[model samples]
Target: MSVSVDLATVWAFIIAFAVFVYIVMDGFDLGLGILFPLFPAKADRDVIMNSVAPVWDGNETWLVLGGGGMMAAFPLAYAVLMPALYTPVIAMLLGLVFRGVAFEFRWRTRRERNLWDIAFAGGSLVAALAQGVALGAILQGVHVEGRHYAGGWWDWLTPFSILTGVALVIGYALLGATWLVMKTEGELRERAYHLSWIFLIAMLGAMGAVSIVTPFLHVQYTQRWFAWPNIILTAPVPIAVAGVSALLLRSLAKKYDYQPFSLSLMLFALSYAGLGISLYPYIVPQSITIWQAASPEKSQLFMLFGVAVLIPLILGYTAWAYWVFRGKVNTASGFH
Candidate 1:
């Protein structure tokens, strides 16, 4: 017997995977930018910047794939979402542009380095906040009228969106701190470990607050999580979160270099899985479904062939780059 799968669902998962990879890959670098203010010393800043310099540009590849895939495979959803999320989306792109420019310019000039640093941190913060707010806006549901976004411009700004924005900033900072702990040594690593602890506590609080408020936003979400046999399936996610939290704390206390970062990624994976549970089937979350938004079968099949070859090549090079740059960052050596 052969199992059958839907092409639209396949594309959905593909897009989801790309987005998740982008989050985990670029998240640490963005986190480093967020943590910059905490490390005021020039030398400390150098180490932080150097840690991500080699692969920072490459990390954004997945973002392109995810966005492009959405536009190609789900044009209707893209059309509706773009109008609804125009403000936040534009803000995110602009933030990334500033951040990228700062990343390059900071190394070129000594006198203007401080200005670049501010740009880097500010851009990362804005990008992170905008991404989270867009997510919150999606979760709260978009205003749809005959396949068009009918919501006001300011509709994306809400208390819940602000909460998620702050949560994401804290989460990214944690990723950055743990990354520093894994990639640097001596005073910097020690300082990172301390920040990791603080960020961990703050992240947990933020996660709890979001989790509590999320289910109440939509009745469907509440049912998906808390109803009957669904609870059995969903129960393990929070349990896994607790388990990972324990391991993260243990790893941090043990002073194990890579474990804290690995466990931190696991926590993120669990959170991502929880998000999938919340928003599966509905790409636009109660507005447009995966099937409803899918392009023609021929188009998806044609795209699938390209993606099949493309994804592995991306994975290969990404892995190769990381392997080449593996182990602690040397501030004196410099990546650039």
Candidate 2:
């Protein structure tokens, strides 16, 4: 049998892929920014910011690409999701604005730089938490009435959603700490190594609990994933995550031959891959399947053509940005 082009399906996959990319790429930077204050000293905070300063803005381009692409490619999905997620979305956007302002003003606004730093940290935290709440709500599922939600105002803020929010905070912070370890040397690097153990364990614990809980809540996902050949295909997720986690731990334990940051990143990527698997084919999970919620073929094709051109350009610039600023960060240097 041969596969045929389902334009809607194709667009759905592309939008999903873009979102995953954004999460993996920009997530760490935001996480690091949020984790900045965890450092015992102001000098350490400066080091952390310097590590992220070069590519922090570039890291966020993924969100726009993922979001805009979703709106264009899957208009129907957006119509349904936006109303359901309205408050959290507003909060997320506001937080992102704060995060952005904090990033920019922190450097130039001398007397108010401290204030901006706090704002930046607060924004990052809020945005990350809001996202977790959104994800948890999506996973628990929702009731739909045509393209809008039938669920009540507070339905999106369930116990599961709140748990997910807290989990993500630790997850992001770990990512940030690992990233700092990877990009900085000397004292800051060592400190990041120490931080990774606690945060990574918390992330894994949260993920473990979620994995067990998801199946019972949505039997369809459980049966589909845990059944036969599908289970075999899914086996790699836990295995890979475990392998990376072990590597991260081994590196930390040994300390002398450490590559703390890069390995931690691989760990994050693996964990995210597991999430992508768990929520497969449902852009919004059980609430809306991809094909059912897709926009028209003509619309999707037109949007795809544009995205095909746009994605490459975005990838190119992102690569260039990272290359331009590749190196270890040190104290006494401005974030220019």
Among these predicted structures, which one has the highest TM-score?
A: 1
What's the distance in Å from true for residue 24, model 1? Answer: 0.5
Per-residue lDDT, model 1, residue 249, is: 98
The TM-score that candidate 1 achieves is 0.97
Residue range 1-336, candidate 1, lDDT tens digits: 111138888999999999999999998888999999999999999999989988999999999999999999999999999998999999999989999999999999999999999999999999999989999999999999888899999999999999999988899999999999989988999999999999999999999999999999999999999999999999999999999999999999999999988898898899899999999989998888988899888899899999999999999999999989888975786542
Encode model 2's per-residue lDDT on 163-272: one tens digit a residue: 88888788888878777766777888778777888888888898787767777668777876798878998888888888878877887787733366677667667766
Least lDDT summed over 10 consecutive residues: which range in candidate 2? 1-10
Computed on alpha carbons, the lDDT of every model, listed in order, comes to 0.92, 0.77
Candidate 2 displacement at residue 305 in angstroms: 1.6
Q: Supply the TM-score for candidate 2.
A: 0.92
